[model samples]
Structure formats: C-alpha cells, structure tokens
Target: MSFTVLLEFQLKDGVENAPEILREVLAQTGAFAGNEGLEVLIDDDDASKLIVVEKWASVDARNAYVAWRATPEGRTVSAS
Candidate 1:
C-alpha cells in the first residue's frame, strides 16, 4: 500500500522563524527519491504548531528513505 508520513514540529515559545525553516526543510525532503508529494499544514488554533504530510510511492520506498536518513551522509546534508 502507499505510505503516508506525518511529521509534526512544535516550536518553542516565541519562535518566529518557522516559515524560513519549513522552506529549507521541505525543499530538501521533497527532493527525495520516494517522495510523491509534500504538504505543510498549520494548526488552526496555534501558529507555532506545524505538520508536514509526505506521500510516498510505497511502504518500501518510505522505509528506504527513513533508513537513508539515519546515515552519516544524510545527516550532513540534512543539517545544511
């Protein structure tokens, strides 16, 4: 079956830079091989809460992507 991943980021009090951070993060993540698409959603009641919805082609694809993210190379690139 197709896989969906939901990543939620809860910001600390008064952190006002989520847009910039999301732009960078989404760009990198959306470029992954298995990513069918990505969407960023904001909480209706709280501006500080954000959710990233990722659609993957398949469960294998999603698992592979998650495994790659644990590698040193993935860590380095993701930190940029």
Candidate 2:
C-alpha cells in the first residue's frame, strides 16, 4: 500500500527566509528514493502554518526515510 506522511511546521514571526528553507528541504526530499511526490500547502487562515504532504511507494519506504532522518546527514539536511 502507498504511504503518506503529513508534516506540519509553524514559522516564527517575521522569518523572511522561510521560503528559501522550504525550497531547499523540499528539494532534498524530492530526491530521496521511493518518493512519489511532495506537496507544500499553506493554510488559508494561517500564514505561519505550513503542511507538507509526502507520498511514498510503500510504508517500508516511508519508514526507511524516517529512520534516515535520525542520522547525522539527514539531520543536517532537515535542519537546512
């Protein structure tokens, strides 16, 4: 079965560089193996809130990606 990951992020006030950070993180996410697609959605009522919808080929693939995100390199990418 396909796997979907929903991530939510709340930006700090007046964070002007959020767009660049989002682009970079999403770019890295898209290049990950087994990724079907990743969509970034902005809340209609809240500008500071963002939702990331990620689709993977399978639950295993999603789990693997989650595991990788705990590693040093993955943490670096995530922090970027």
Candidate 3:
C-alpha cells in the first residue's frame, strides 16, 4: 500500500534565510533515492510554519529513506 507523510517545521527565530535553507534541504532530499512525490507548503496564518507532504509507493521505501539518514556512514543532512 502507498504511504504518505506530513512533516511540520517551524522556522528558527530570526531566520531571514529560511526559504533558501528549506529549498536546499528539500532539493537534497528529493534527489535521494525512494523519494517519489514531494511538496512543501507554508501556513497562511503563520508563514514561519511549514509543512512537507510526501507520497511513497510503500512503507519500505519511506523507511529506507529514514534509515539512510540515520546512519553515521550515510548522508549527513544539515541540522540547523
């Protein structure tokens, strides 16, 4: 069965470069394997709040992506 994920993020205080940082991070994630469909949105009521929606073919695919990120030997996603 297909799986969907909705991730919520709040921009750090005084993050003027929030958009650029988000875009780069998303680009990197989408470029990775097992990422099928991805979309990001901002709350109309709160611009600093962001949501990322992803649709994957299966739960395994989604788990694979998470595992890839969790490993010390794997890609090191920026954490700022």
> Which is the leading candidate under lDDT?
2
lDDT, candidate 1, 3-79, per-residue tens: 78899987676546656666766786789887899997899999778898999999888888778778885552222
CA RMSD, predictions in order: 3.0, 2.2, 2.3
lDDT of each: 0.77, 0.82, 0.78
Residue-pair clashes per candidate: 0, 0, 0
Off by over 4 Å in 2: 77-80
Per-residue alpha-carbon lDDT of candidate 3 for residues 1-80, written as tens digits (9 for 90 to 100)? 88789999888887666778777767767876667888988899988898899888788888888887688755654545
Candidate 1's C-alpha lDDT?
0.77
By summed lDDT, the worst window of 10 consecutive residues in model 3 runs over 71-80
Ranked candidates (lDDT, high to low) = 2, 3, 1
Off by over 4 Å in 3: 72-80
Candidate 3: RMSD to truth: 2.3
- Please give, for residues 1-80, the per-residue lDDT of candidate 2 as tens digits: 77789999898777677777778778878888889999989999998899999999988888788788788877633232
After superposition, the stretches of candidate 1 with alpha carbons farther than 4 Å from their true spots are: 14-18, 76-80
